[model samples]
Target chain A: MKRAASRLAALSLALLAGTPAALPARAQDAPPATRPSDDQAEVLAKVEKYLELAKSGTAAVRPQAARRLAQLGEPARARLVELAGADGAGLAELGPQVVEIAADFGDAGLRAALWRVLADADFPWRGSAARALAKAPVADEGAAFRGLGADHLWQVRFAALDALRALDLRDARAAVRALLVDQEGAVRRAAAALLVDWGEPGALRWLVEELRREDAYFRVPLGAQARFDAHKRLTELLGDDFGFRPGESPATPANAAALARLEAAARERAGDAWPSELPPIARAAGASTGDVLGLELRSCRAGEFYLRWNDADEVHVGTGNAAVVTLAPGTVERLRAGIERRVAELGDTRFWGEAGCDLEQYRCVGADGELRTWLLSKGQASEGDLRPAPLDAVAELLLLTLPDEASADPRLDRLRSRARAALSVLGGAL
Target chain B: MISLRSLLPALLLVGLGAAAPSAEDATVVQMVELNNVEYQIGDDLPDWVIALDGQRIEIAGFMRTGTLEGETWFDLTNDSCGCGTSKLQHFVRVTLESGTTSFTPDELTLTGTFAAGEQEDEDGFVESIYRLTITSL
Candidate 1:
């Protein structure tokens, strides 16, 4: 199996290596006269300023800057390309943003630049290129996605799958099917999601299997949103009861039941060929607490999602417009224990709040019907009207109920990770 | 011709006589100043921001209504549209101290107590980041 996996990886690398050096449809194919009109020097300077703001400026500045650059259109493309290719300290950070900015042009230069980045095997920004290309609405979508879908890098492959799914390319079904059993859960989930979007029976079967696995958590690094998308797709394909919650840990009975129901539904929809019995949850070594806990984290604009423990013995998690649905079981006792131990370990660690970031509040109603709430700021602030992360047990419980904030804000995610780390620290006086 | 959009804010600031107000008095806070992106991802906040807490402050932005139509509070965003509800980092929730107003596209300048922290609704949502109990608009 290891050898086979290695061989598959090698084959994927080989396929990526064999991609065409240049697409016939690219802007660079034209003569030098085809180069886009450059912006006025002052305008270019403004564009540069916005670009800088988009990178390291204030939140208010970043989005506005990005919007300005996008509105500037082709005038900003050349500079964006230059920044994307620069070897400066933070230039690489601009790759994804550049790709997004490039999409506004939807011109040949965007296509050409993306192709150049993706075709070059050693390109530092291949992942960004793939992601950008996926959304670029290129003329030759099939060849681009086909070449990239077999990329050695999991990110590139995932992007390719995303592109295929978005484009609804029927021919790429075989390639997408191959990724169903990928080594990475994200890749597999992406592949399954693509299939589900395409309404393929194979996707139904694959998702059911994922629901049955021991490590059923559909966590993909920086991909809680994608996982949520797949869960929604699955629920749509199966019955309403089969809807999977995005942030809910897949270890819950409600999730298991949902998966089981989904599997049965898939069998009915796709025929009896699909597997019937998914792997059952193994009992923990010690006596487990059947206590269920619900946690939620919401920010004003950039973050709004919750994981509520419903009376139906299910975790109801919501991301975007999707209705609250069951996910795998959450580790309520373990999480509470982790919070308690960490709070005890670090006596009186100060918690601070920020001006722009949203307040993260965690609420857990105990089995005894005692409701407690903990309000946490995204980060530690020294002087502001601040609420500390688990400033007390109530606060800690709120931090524990962190649903993946898919607000597309890295700051919120980092705050969630920080809260989890602070709560998970076993011991050591600070 | 020069695009007036970029220069408009500077011109407005000049008109408003942008000056540092005393801590006991009112301070002017721009969305850019409040939502500076330079801060690191974790919980540690910059000290300069801590100084702004509990201060009477003034800010300018576009006004937006809350999730529910009849809700008394509205939001102020850097963008004129004030469209998206997520990313609280880019907006300030504004509650009028006196009368209520409908949503408007034009930028509105308001004065209020700049309250900052995590405030959750009964339904478990972060209601605001920078909230202003508006004394004037």
Candidate 2:
């Protein structure tokens, strides 16, 4: 995933020349062009400053500025939109420039300007504003949505369909739903998508009908001409040195091996490690509460723990894959040791009997107090549900998991060994 | 018996697949956004929503509101494999004998039920389907 994300970043940078990693698509593809660093920034500053003079800027200036800003992508667009969002005397100065910018940059600006225009009802600007928003990468979704809910113009209402179709805000489901009855076919199409994204009950009924009706993606096998066309297009995506041998398919074994090696090297980073050491995915677990470590895996299953906050009152909390422990001042240190010891013990154990379960999907759980020692089963076990294993037995289990001098992820077992010892001390303290 | 025109598009309804919907006699065909999966009939078909829940949905107004024009076949399964999950599809083509047989130009309620879906690759919002159901009304 890390490699994939970096590759994506590299591809985007390639599309947008001049940055930290701006290697042209091909050396030959590099154009004889050079641009100053702040060239884009200067135009943007002026656009903000030239709001009153939006129409007055040199024909080339604002258009270039808007185009450059679009290239700055979402981060820049987000900043501009946010500035517009903050209302004040600055709006009048900002408004017209925004209008012109959206119009000037074509589809890109149109998408950016959609949200701001949705906030205003001023006519000529509003209509163009809406159209700009729909140019391609959609915008103005939330505003048009809020308006269409009570809008008078069916044209505007119809445009609402387009607005919804273009708008991709995750939280705007409410606004989208309000336009469900829009009087235009375009509007209905927008509604279908919104309903589907948000999983509205009605959207399904409608989609099922549409699905049965539409077959747009893939059809029958292509004819000879189509196949040739596909081949031509596919070649465009092929890299240089694609055909290792004269006229040989670029997808041959030797080339494939080289490409695989390059890809592997490119994607060397691993994902962030999961936090298995952290107990109770929640916060605040204490010895006083019979709160066992609680972890909830995925969204489906849940677990609970009954831990005592201190030496007195019993605290019970159930969590799976996560927990919160609120131990007394010294409790943390002691339990950390206990947990480490237990991990070492568990690791050393030969066979883990899950009764009837996949051990991979299970984990070791334990809790103890001064009076009673509780060993939890891999699945869900409660206060009285523990079966005590000898401390040596537990140590044996830990040894099994612990790595020798040359293993990977060895730290996990090592950490467990140390944590279990502290846990035992804490249990004895209580 | 429903023709492939309407019945076939029913198969494409899983996830967000196409913008140009099938069905020659589209009682309603307008673009809309699937914001929230407001309500679903059965299982994990989170893409659909119900208008009765008062969730606002964006839609292009369709001139024709469908009623049980006649018995039209409907598919019950949302799985990509085409397995039927409910008895619902059997009745879709079977002239939906319901009160929602017709629609007004005004954004009408997609009362049957709906499911929201993923977004499209192009410039449109996500696709949603409103399975208009007909009760004794």
Candidate 3:
């Protein structure tokens, strides 16, 4: 439980240091001289045995105890909950250790107990329960998130918000939007950032206004620069220079003038309904609702370049010549779907094996407003003859971007067909 | 090239100066220092690195072979697992003076002479930013 508390505090983004001992658990409220009866002693012994088996057992043996505990149903649930509510000294240290195992139980009765703890106004374990739920696959995800978000504690609320962000639940959009005015600065920041990521309509305006506030100052460290986090996100959403330079003070006369100019530009752009002529980054950040994608290629052997489709339906591939070609009608939507499918294949794994001389990189801006990059390399492992090879489809796409005279060789015809087959899943005459 | 024996006399005459390090003293160059963002992006290695050109130094990193055969002269990188994006200065060339030693997957600690420059092939792609002639491994 202590470790869970510390992890929650660190992930809160509230700029607060957590001391494990300072936070009291439910055991602190109980009378000191109370002794366990025979039934309670048996329950405690069984809980300890199950915890030990879960911790030290191998993959084959571990699931047996975990399953048995889950099958024990209500009795196991009650004992584990009591242990989790224990103080953070000696044996109580086991409280944090048993959370993942207990979650693996995935029993309805146990899950109900956890939900009760989460919803309980008197329980001091709400933060711990919310955090465990964030990692666990709960059945009533939407309802659990809603309840946790409304908790009185800021830490619990922040954890719930983070869970909502990771799940990217479209159904909970209204609830998430309500958190934009949260009392804690960290919660408000997280809410605004998640809204921007989902391409919500009013998110950009809220972010800009946050930066323009009189109390706004750089309180968080971002890379080499010390600008307000809102300002940084705004720059990422809009262009790098979004109408004004970030000066040292928000109250300075020069800064105020610059901000006025920025606000004027924003208001004018918003009035136009955000035409597609704006930058691709701006369009991805919800400035406009048309199709604009970023494509980048980097190689140790063939060199590096970026490609993007402009508002005029022209694709610019920077292949030494800055080559521009017009795409056929309906090709843009097909391309967007193609990119989305490719990104889904690269979820948690970006690159595999060691670096090789022949390395190729492919990047794309997905239709869902997220940027994805993948690396394909030819690598030989330490002891094996088996070597890793680059993706053939991506290599063919790369060849298409190069100059026609060099890439138009007849030998590439087979590969080109394969590449088109992979990229053109929508299947028309592009 | 100035021999290690010849640089010693010059160091004694110059006498323990902070600006110029003698060849006898082993300098340690961190990967973070070599990849400093302050350096200008260009074909040539910056002048600031030239101070440690001929000096012996010790560096620790992961080993990677240039070809499938796994030769003795390999590229050492900041990340052994090859998990993230890489830049030019993230690798240093290490050549074994005593010929091919067995390649090991573990992180290797090496002592060698540090050489700073940009070497390109006939196609003019940057081959390296730093090179080391191994004295010990």
Prediction RMSDs, each to the true structure: 19.2, 27.5, 28.4
Off by over 4 Å in 3: A1-82, A85-113, A136-139, A212-228, A231-248, A251-430, B1-137
C-alpha RMSD (angstroms) for model 2: 27.5
Candidate 1 recovers a fraction of native contacts equal to 0.00
Candidate of highest lDDT? 1
Angstrom error at residue A342, model 2: 97
lDDT over C-alpha atoms for residue A68 of model 3: 54
Q: Per-residue lDDT of A1-430 in model 1, one digit per residue for the tens? A: 4333333323333333445454234432545443322334445555666677655443334444566778876446655644444332233456334454555666564566667666665344466567767765554677778777667556778788877766778788899877765544557777766776676664566565544332211111112333344465566666474545443435566666766666577678767445454222111111112324434333322223444444444443332211233334555555555555544443533222322223443444444554434334432122333443334454445444554455433223444454454433211111
Residues A174-257, candidate 2: write the lDDT tens digits: 666655433222343355455655544334222212111111101111111122222222233222222222112224576455
Q: Best-fitting candidate, measured by TM-score? A: 1
DockQ of 2: 0.03
lDDT of 3 by residue, A1-430 (tens): 5344333322221212244344345333434343244564454455546666544432222334444555565556655544554331222233323443455455444455556655654333345556666766443586768666766555577778777876777677888877765544455656767776786635555555544433210111111121255566666665554444342344457666766766565555456443334222111111112325543332221223345554455555432112455666766556556655655655565554344323334445565555454544443222232112233433343435333433432212243343333222211112
Candidate 1 lDDT by residue in tens digits, B2-101: 7886445434534433324645456766564454323322344344444455666777665532222345677777533222213546578778776665
Assess each model's interface with DockQ, reporting 2 decimals per model.
0.03, 0.03, 0.03
Model 3 scores what on Cα lDDT?
A: 0.48
